[model samples]
Target chain A: MKYVITLLVGMVTGAVAFVLLLYYNPFVGNQSVSPLAVSELDLVDFSYSLLASDSIVFTNDGESHMQPHPAKVLQLWEPTVKMTRALVTILNDSRGQPAGLGVKFSSDSEKTRLINAEVVVDSVWHIYSPEHGTFFVDQTENFWPYLHDIVVPARLSGGDSWRGSWYGITSTGPGALGIARVTGGAGDFADTEGEAVESIAARAYSAITGPVAMTGKLTIALPRQEALP
Target chain B: MLKIFYLGIVMGIAAAAALVYIYPVVDQHREPSLITVRPNGGNSESFHIRLPGDRIMAGVTGSTELTPLALEWPEHDFLANMQTELFKVRNENDVVIGAASRMSGWSEQHGSFVEWVVHLPARGSMFMTMAAKPSADGYREGKLRAGTREFLTLNGTVIERFVNEADDSDSDNVGRIELVTALVGLPDELE
Candidate 1:
C-alpha cells in the first residue's frame, strides 16, 4: 500500500506539471496573428521625377557644317501616381494555414492586388507581386529595397510608431525608367530622392537630355482602432 | 523513484521541443548587396559592382562594338557620343550625397571624347570617359578610362585607377562605360 500510494502521488505530480507546461507553451498560441492582424493599411506616399526632353538636334557631320534637324518631343501624362490605403485580408490555403495577403487598393476604387507569400531556403517571408516580382521583407528594417515597398508593422498596437528606408528602381513603367529611394513613415517621407531619365528615343532625338530630380518629405498617420468600421 | 525518473525524461523531451518551436535555429540565406550598372538599357549586358563594405570603392566598365554598317563613312568625321548616362555616389555611411544623369555629346574626331567630372560631397571626385572607333578589320575598337580621387580630412589624396582598357573587337567589348566610387569620411547627414 505504501508503494502504491507513492506511485500514485508521483503520477499526479507529473500530470499536473505536464498540463502547466502545455498551457504556457508560447509557440502554440498564434503564428498567423502576429504578422498580419491589421484591418487597414496606410498608403505608401512616393515622390519621383519625370524627365523628358523638349527638343532634339541631329547633325550629319560631327560639326556645324550640316544643317541640324530637330526631332519631335515625346509627351508624358500622369507622371506620378500615389499608392493609397489598402484593406488587408488574410488568405488561408487548403490546409487552413496562412498563405498570403489579399490587398485592395483604396485609391484605385477597390482594385485588389494579390501578394503571394513564399518561405525561401532562408525561412524568411518573401512577398511577391505580379507587377513588381518577388521581394523580401526586412522585418528589422521594415522596408524592401528592391521593390521600394514600405509598410508599418501590422503587429503594432494603437499609438505605436515605426520608421524605415527604401531605395531601388521600379521594375515596370511607361516612360524611361525612374530610380527612386525614400525613407519615412505614416504621412511623412524623409530623404526622398529619385530621378527619371529620358527614354532612349527621347534622348537620341533631343541632343540635350537629363533626368528630372525630386526631393521631399512624406507623412502618414495610422487610424485608431476606434475609427475602423 | 522509477516513475519520477521517467517523468523527468519525458518533461526534458517536451521542453526541448518547445524551445525549438519557439526559437528556431535556421540557416539564413542572405544575398550580397549588388550595385548593378546597366548600360544601353539592356539587362542582359548589365554587370554588378561590388561594394565590399563601408569606406570601400569598387566598379566594372566594358566597351563593345556594335555591327558596323555595310557602307563606309568618313574616318575622321565619324560621330560617336559616350556619356556616363546615370550614376549614384554614396559615402561611408551609405548615404547619397550626389546623384545625377548628365548627358554630354561630341563628334568623334581623332582622339576626341566627352569627359565627365563629378564631385562627391565630403568624399572625393570621379573622372570617366568613353571613346570608340572603327577598326581596320571592320570591327569597332573602344577604350574606357575611370579613376577615383579620394580626399581624407587627415590624410592626403588617395588616387585609385579602377579600369583602363584599350582593345580590339575580338576582346570582351560590351560597349558600356560605368564608374562607381565610394569615399571614406563622415559627412554631414543628408537632409
Candidate 2:
C-alpha cells in the first residue's frame, strides 16, 4: 500500500510536468530571418536549368520517389495526378550575379500537361550545388519536406527575391515553352516586373514523365531605390 | 509503505509518459472524416480542423500565436519576413494527418498575395495562391490553384479562419483552417 501511494504521487508530478512543458514552455514563439540590402541595380537577368536527376516526384496512384543528380527520366504509369519539386541550377550567363530559381509544379495524369506551377527566385537561399548535388549540410540528405533551417548557400547575394505563378506544358523532348510572371517580391525585385521563359527536354518522344530536362531565362526590371542617407 | 514511495513515484512518472505517447498514436489511427457534399451536382468534400498548436517557421519551432504584423517597409531578411508559417494539418476530429505551410506578403507588383501549401500523407499535396487579404474578422479565402494525387481532379476553395479567444490557461494564438474542395468529375469511389 505504501508503494502504491508513492507511485501515485510520482505519477501526478509527471502529469504536471507534461502539462507545463506543453503549455507554459518558453520556447514557443515566432521569429523571422532577414536578408541583406543590395546596391543600386535596375535590370537583373539570369538563366537556370532543371536538375532532373535531383528531382523529387510524387503521385497519387503512381510511384513516388527521388532521382538524384544526373537522373534523366522520372517514370510513372497511369498516374491521375503527379507533382515534381526540383531545384533549378542557375547558369553562369547572368549579366549580374544571379541568385537562383526554385521550381515546383503538379501535372495531370498524363504527366505531359502542367496544371499548377510556381517559382521562387532569391539572391541568398539556395539548395543547389556545383558538383551535381543539393545544398543539404549532409550531402546524403536529398529530401526537403522534412528539413528546416536549411543551410543558406549564399550562392549569390544582392537582396533580390521574387515569387510568382508559372504555367506551361510538361511534354517530353523539347517541350513547349512555359512562362512565369513576377507577382510579388522584395529587395532588388521590389516594385519590379519581369517574366521567365522556360523550355523543357525529355527523352520520351511523346507525353511521358521520363528523363526530364529544362532551361530558362529570367529577366526582371528593378525600380530605382532611393539612396539612403 | 515509506520505502515504496520512491518506487511509486517512478512508476507513476512512467505511466504518465506512456499516456502522453499513446494519445497521438490513437489519434492518428482514428478513422479520418471524409465528408462529401454535392452542390449543383458536383462532388464537394470539406475538411474543417482547428490548428491551435505548434509551428515551425524559417527554422523557428514554437507554439503559434496570432501576432498582428505591421506591413510597412520591406524587411531586409526577406525569407524570414515572409513568415512562412508551417503547421500540422489536423482533421475536425483532431486527427493528425498531414502538414501545411502558409505565407502572405505585399509588393508593388501585387498589392497582397497569399501562398499556402497542404501536404496530405501519402495522398499527395496541393498549392493555393490567393490575391485576397485577411479581413478584420481574421479569415483569408482563395481558390485552389493546383494539386497532386487526390487533389488533382478537384477544383475548390480554401478558407482559413483565426479564432482569438482569451484563454487564461493557454497564452498562444489559436486558429482554425478550413479546406472546402469541390472536385469536378471525381469518381465517387476514388479514395
Provide per-model DockQ scores: 0.03, 0.08
> lDDT score, residue A60, model 1?
17
Model 2: lDDT to the true structure: 0.37
lDDT of 1 by residue, A124-153 (tens): 111111211111111111112211122223
lDDT of 2 by residue, A73-184 (tens): 2222211112322232334345534343233322221221101111111111122211111111100111111011111111122332112222222211111122233322
**Candidate 2 per-residue lDDT over residues B71-99, each given as its tens digit:** 11112332222333444455555565554
The complex in candidate 2 yields a DockQ of 0.08
Reference-based lDDT, residue A9, model 2:
76
Q: How well does candidate 1 score on lDDT at residue A216?
A: 17
Candidate with best TM-score:
2
Cα lDDT for residue A32, candidate 2: 17
What class would a CAPRI assessor give candidate 1's docking?
A: incorrect
A83 in model 2: Cα distance from truth in Å? Answer: 16
- The regions of model 1 sitting more than 4 angstroms off are A1-42, A45-229, B1-11, B14-24, B28-191
Off by over 4 Å in 2: A1-229, B1-33, B46-52, B58-81, B135-138, B186-191
lDDT at B36, model 2: 68
In candidate 2, the second chain superimposes onto the true chain B with a TM-score of: 0.61
- lDDT over C-alpha atoms for residue B94 of model 2: 53
